[model samples]
Target: MQAAGPGSNTARPRNAAACVQVRLDDLIAQRIAARSLVLAASRKVSAAQAGVKASRFRGRGVDYVESRGYQPGDDIRSMDWRVTARSGRPHTKVFQEERERSVLLVIDHAASMRFGTRVCFKSVQAARAAALIAWSAIRGGDRVGALGFGSGVTGEVRPAGGPRGVLHCLRALADWDTLARVERESGPAPLSQALERARRLARPGSLVVLLTDGFSSDAAAEAPLARLAGHGDVRLLLMTDALELAAPPRGRYAVALGGVRRWLEFDAAAADTQWTDAFRHRRELLLQQARRLGVAHIAVDTRDDLSRCLAPLGLALATRRSYV
Candidate 1:
């Protein structure tokens, strides 16, 4: 077969070919290297002119205030052993509530995110969005962390403050984005599993952002998402592709999976009506459920510019800094 020219529409062999990967340097350039990019994006947050509700109950505190005699309702875990021994009375350590909010980026690198026909793959776009949010969060004096799920639950990064936390989260994002391009044959970890893990990682008043294609039919995640939203802020960045919603041109096409190449006969006229309807139904159902569950849903397409696409969400986030 003749080689695919500079502009061929055929899907290339993902396994045999060196898939275009997201480089660490490039991510750094977009984030730390280009400090102004992050600063500019952050500046827009204040312009939103929205006030974030302060957290109601103190979740966790950073600085210790003072030691006092233990009250009947005081938590035993907060006992000051030394003070109790010295004073011959039970004493409890008092800590001031931490002002910093924790932001967790639950990024999905499932196989579905690996394909894109426009600007970049969904996986890469997800990474960019995560990076932008991480920077914004850290700049706002909030802690940043991540729970990544690719072929399976890849890993989690505990929340931390300042540049260190943002760097750690971005590193994990880049790593997972590269791994997704490898084309693993194993089934992807259910989106529900990731949500469950997020439920555990997030504390009350925390901000949780879920980045995915939003094509899953798994209803199991509904409860967890609602639970998380109940105690913390939950936002969804639904990654989508223009082609996914509709059939491609009616013609024969070469589809590549792993190292094998196969021919797929694409005829919109002969396409199964039920399958098309199912796709539309699933998409609508996912959005409807997200709204019903009281989570902010933003549709992010592969063609979208990361910074521009995320600007409006920044405003929503501005009002979400503090949660009950």
Candidate 2:
């Protein structure tokens, strides 16, 4: 009576539940109350641009500000041909810079995030950093939205410009991990889906804060990232694990699937160049791209308190008058 019972079907429920976003709204709210540094927690914004917003970075919207007589040293490119035709004088029309903007955060949650050494996993650090940014954005009077990505799931929240909306997003991001365990069986949604959705939803001149491990294998993770380059102002913060960059010393392991031998390796030093080089090199280039995109490049270790990273991002927007 040795009938092979049910052929290990455990993966069914897990896979089926992959995309369901379980709301950890309550837990996230509590964490925000405890861990958040925002002073006026209950404050709401009145003017459309009251709270912290990204448009400030846009630096005054483009407009026909004024005309100046063309100087001999003026580049030909600055010459206002239309103005020249309008008036019988060589003049250069000055255009106002874009000042208003929204910031959209696209967060990644691949299974790889679960692996970390210091304080938490990459996912935990990512969520924490994201929540801070969201709160700061709300304070800046900038609209904010989020897209959570990983093993085929995308959790979305519409952009909100006031305190209430910011609170809502903070709660969602804070409890994201618990929610993922309950609602998602697969890992996070795919990167492509999250970025694609952000691209479509974000307005022109918006700032996109992409929080990821830069773990994409698709040709240097550049092609997928390039997809967002044209959308608006982009900022990339690569959330990394200590082990991925600087592993522990001298461990030997073999990967196995039943009888199939996958990989076997042994290293004397924890920080083996051969093994960790890929992540290191990627980090450098990740920052380089951010530089090129005029985006902020941040490297965060999941093991440390996220505040180390978040505090600076907050500082970048901490100016009181700047908020106005």
Give per-model TM-scores. 0.72, 0.58
Tens digits of per-residue lDDT for model 2 on 149-208?
665446777776666776666665645655554454443354555666787777765667
Model 1 lDDT tens row, 104-220: 999887777776665556676677777777777777677889998866547899999888888888888777776666646387677677889999999887889899886653677
lDDT of 2: 0.57
Candidate 1 RMSD to the real structure = 8.5
Which residue runs of candidate 1 sit more than 4 Å off their true CA positions?
A: 1-19, 32-97, 183-185, 258-260, 270-285
* Top of the candidates by lDDT: 1
TM-score, prediction 2: 0.58
